[model samples]
Target: MARIAVIGAGTGAMAAAARLAVAGHRVTVYERSGTYGGSLGRYARDGFVFDTGPSLLHLPAVYRDLFVKTGKEPLERCVTLTQVDPASRHLFADGTAVSLPDASRAGVVAALDQALGEGAGTRWAQFLDRAGTAWDRSRRPLLEEPLRDDREVAARDPYPAPRRRRLLRPARQAATLAQIGAWELADPRLAALLDGYALSYGLDPRRAPAAAALLPYMEQTFGSWYVSGGMRELAGALYERCVLRRVEFVFGAEVVRVAEKDGRAAGVELADGTHADADHVVLGAQPGPELVPSQAWDATGTRSAGRAAAPGRFVVMLSLRGAREAGAVHRTVVHCEDGTGEQEAVFGGRIADVPTVTVSRPDDPSTRPDEAHEAVTLTATVAPHGPVDWTDPALRERFADVLTGRAALAVPGLRERILRAEVRTPAETAADTGAAGGSVPAPALAGAGGAFLRPGNRTALPGLYLAGGWSHPGGGPAHAGMSGALVAGLVVEGDGFRGSR
Candidate 1:
């Protein structure tokens, strides 16, 4: 049996450790932090609980499969997974509101038509149909399998955009997501809806490829989910599963560098001036020369190309004195009026005057002290830490106020109802995640000349592999889990391992 050493206790790393252990490999995970879960963090004060990471989950089948493969107990047995009805409520700039049903195209269409206009639903339905086509074309190479060297197949945009004819101009198909919204959806409100999806994932809709349409298709088709306690419970469940598989974990054990023997990854050197030898290594953190001595990897050709300037999230956690209103929508998005200004500010290293905000108020009692009180979370995509000085008290308070003001649209008397407010910026994210500039990585896309694809799982080093949000197939819970699976596949079945059937 090969002794495998994994760097970091993040979701992806832990997932790989469990799988490798189940395969009869002796695996040990070293994490710098005192905990697991990486971005799936939780904060609690005065009996109020808040999920510091992703509030909702999409594509839960990834974790479901992991649980099944690792043990007999399915995911549901470990955590309560409930499909959120009216998946989300959208508050448009013009005071128009619509609540889309979960995983129902017909229901979403009807709701859009009722709120936006008669033709709005039909236009959106058609757009999603095209988006569905993109999902089908790219699902295999981009998601289901390990990233291949000949990326020509995955590099090409799979989105079958409708061709449009302009006066005295040759017929052209939409390239960017913005183009698809304008050319196909044909409504400012509809376009904003589409842009909201892109921004939530840290993608600039203006530059994101048309293939990004698959995001909404994925969410709307698979549906949004919520755990009974919070997303943190999911992490706890996975961590327990790993322990059950006999995977050893070392908390607060920081890996300083990847050790090499005869030019192959042999083990890891810890920050405490210690080393543990292994037959193979899986790196889940951000790759760098200090960690991996290999110099053959090119950051420019992978998702790390934009790591320095990637977008991040600004979160405001509110403890309200009043109980959640009956029939309150679980998730509500307050759309910004000026999409261009918001995009330019977020990407151009500035803060927008008014930014799009997502408000999550899950109908779960565990998050509050009692039914008389409620916990609410507001999140917005913003410039990463380098561009914005999130450390400044003035800046933090001002931005928190801005987000809270926008959230007032979703929560009645929001400012008055708040018993306490806590703010978390990219700076906090950097501290918790150890990611440079606190920049969050977006999921990999299949267009823009392969600019959006992440680095392959297999690296230049013979015995070293990459896993997690920063690696192949890119970020998000589902994609990160897939990264772990791919890393295990490559290690167990050798390089010829294509993917799980």
Candidate 2:
């Protein structure tokens, strides 16, 4: 049996550890923090609980497969998963509001038509049909399998843009989401609906490939789900599953560097000047410059390619005095009025004055001390750590106010109802999760000369692999879990392992 050492307790690393252990390998995980979940962080104060990481989970099938493969208990037995109907409520700049039903194209289209105008439903339905084509074309190469050397297949945009020609003008197809929104949808409100999806992931619609439409398609097709407690509960279940399989974990054990032997990864060195030897190593953290010897990681594909800058989230956690009323939506998105200005500000190293805000209010009573209390979370995409001085108390409060003010659009009297408030910035996120510059990696997209493609799971260094949001398939809980599966498959089945069966 190979002795496998996994660095960091991130979702992907833990997922790989569980599977490898179940496959008869002796696995040990070393995490720098006292907790197991990395970015799946949780905050609690005065009996109020908040999920600082992803509020909702999409594509839960990834985790379901992880549980089934690792143990006899299915995912449902470990955590209660519920589909959130009216998946999300959208507030447009034109003062139109619509709540889209979960995973129902007909319902979403009808809602759009009712809120936006006539013909809106038909146009959106047609667009989704086309988006399905992109989903089919890219799902396998992008999510199901490890990235290969031939970038042509994945690099080529899978989105089938319609060809349109004006009088005396040549026919053209859209390359970006913004272009598709303008040329295809041809409605500013519809354009905002599409752009909201991109901006939510910290991506600029003007540059993100049209293939990005797959994001909405994936959500609407598979459906959005929420755990009984919070996302932390899901992480806890995964951690418990790993422990049940005899996977050893050492928390608060910071890895100083990757130990090397005969030009291969031997194991890891701890910050306390200790070492653990292993035959294979899996990295879950972004390969910082000090992570491994410079020569070791110099030419490795495991190293991040330093892609274009992505925005980080500014979160405001509110503990309200009132009880959450019945029939409260799980998520609400307040879109910006000036989409261009918002995009330019965030992507140009500044936070927008009028940024889009997503407010999450789950009806679970466990999140609060009593039925008379409520827990609300507001998130807005902002410039990453370095670009923004989130450390400044005044600046942080100003941004928190902005988020709360915008969220008030969905939840009336939200500011006055707040009994207490807690703000989390990218700087705190970086400290908690170890993301470089506190920049959350955007979900992978197709285009920009394969710029959006994450580095391959296998690196130039022998016996070393990467598994996490920072690795192959890119960010999001689902993608991170998929990366773990791919890494385990490669380590056990060798380079021939494409993906799980």
CA shift of 181, model 1, Å:
0.8
Candidate 1 lDDT at 153 equals: 85
Q: After aligning candidate 2 to the native by TM-score, how far in Å is the CA of 293 from where it should be?
A: 4.6
Ten-residue stretch with the least lDDT total in model 1 = 294-303
Error of 1 at 187 (Å): 0.4
* Candidate that would win on TM-score: 1
Question: How well does candidate 1 match the true structure in TM-score terms?
Answer: 0.98
* Candidate 2 residue-wise lDDT at 309: 48
How does residue 315 of candidate 1 score in lDDT? 93
Q: Give Cα distance to truth, residue 255, candidate 2, Å.
A: 1.4
The residue-by-residue lDDT of candidate 1 on 355-437, one tens digit each, is 99999999999999999999999999999998889999999999999999999999998999999999999999899888887
Compared with the true structure, what per-residue lDDT tens digits does model 2 show for residues 194-309? Answer: 99888888788999898989888889889999998999999999999999999999999999898889988899999999999999999988776588655546654433445544
Question: Candidate 1, clashing residue pairs?
Answer: none
